[model samples]
Target chain A: MKNNIRVERAIHGISQQQLADSVGVSRQTINAIEKGRFVPSTVLAMKIARYFNKNVEMVFALEEGD
Target chain B: MKTSFLLPNKCKKLGKAIFVISAILGFYILFIEESYADGFLIFDSWQAVKNNIAIIGSLLGLALVAFSKERVEDELVMWLRADAMIKALWLSCVLVFLCALFLYGGIYFYYLSVAQYIVLLLYIFIFRYNMYKHIKNNEE
Candidate 1:
């Protein structure tokens, strides 16, 4: 999966820690999602997108390999 | 996610302290005291009793550490833990198979005794290392 969490965080002018706190997770988790090292669950993906005031499809997209 | 199955985060600290203390005591008993090699493996001996205490303490400590929750018990942490456990099981299986093929006699029994605890130790190391790497990579 490909996610533009970094871009959304930049648009919202919030730090990873801030977004993590808002979404009830650690900053490392957010970083992992942004770096594509870890894939978030549906609930977590929805929470992250909701935090950015966007739909999940707007934030996360299907990669060719995925 | 529901992390009710894990021990409280504070247990991690207590677990570390217990593991360290028990490990040091176990080393002293196994090496300096030379209890196991004295041929007093029988349960009636003081050495046997002390050895059992050390073994139980170490096992308890490791169990606590293995099962305790992370500071932020999230889905990512749970995923890492499950991944580490599977890796640990596979690694331990390979080690046990190799030991079974190459070891025999009293030495093989010794290896078997220690092998029981290796999975927990490996899991803790792999999980903690992964968590460390995750945090390190995120540092700005």
Candidate 2:
């Protein structure tokens, strides 16, 4: 339900806009995901994971409440 | 995953132009020309003209709002649309059920369809705007 996208982007030394452009999504969506205000779909989550060259589980994790 | 259901974002511009122009024409024929105060809800020449214009123009506008792609069409946008559609269907059903008790068959059918279309179009924009606003405010 939450993501470490901010940390991932920080590790790659890229801005949210750059990440969004890479993932074919809006920067606001990236921001929302990072803030835990929204959850991305499986396709989007996979796309984000692929962009980081990491496993999907490594990028997105389930919260205790979820 | 890719979905071919979406038109390019440019379609939204065309949709908006159609909606505005037709809306103006519809309103001009409907109210501004004072084509009223004569018949007993009859479909006379002016009434036919007004009805055709208003119904067709609004239906086009509503379809635009319903079908046109978002400026940034993503999974979240799709989810928002699905949510709006589900809620609109429920709300429109409620309206039909409530209105059916008080109205007859012919008018009931027309009113139900209009209610559904209006609810769906209005909620699509309203829900998306509210979600966008919420995200914007949260970012700030």
TM-score leader: 1
Model 2 clash pairs are none
Candidate 2 structure quality by residue, lDDT tens digits, B1-140: 46466666676667677677776776675447745435434355666656565667667766766677777777767777777777877776777778878888867755654663567466766667766785675463
TM-score versus the correct structure, for each prediction: 0.87, 0.74
Model 2 clash tally, residue pairs? 0
Candidates' C-alpha lDDT: 0.86, 0.73
Clashing pairs in 1: none
Report fnat for all candidates as fractions from 0 to 1.
Answer: 0.71, 0.62
lDDT of 1: 0.86
lDDT of 2 by residue, A1-66 (tens): 878888998899999889989889878778888898888888889999999999999999999999
The digit string of per-residue lDDT tens for model 1 on B20-109 reads 887787879755876573444657677777776678878888999999988888898888888899999999999989998999998887
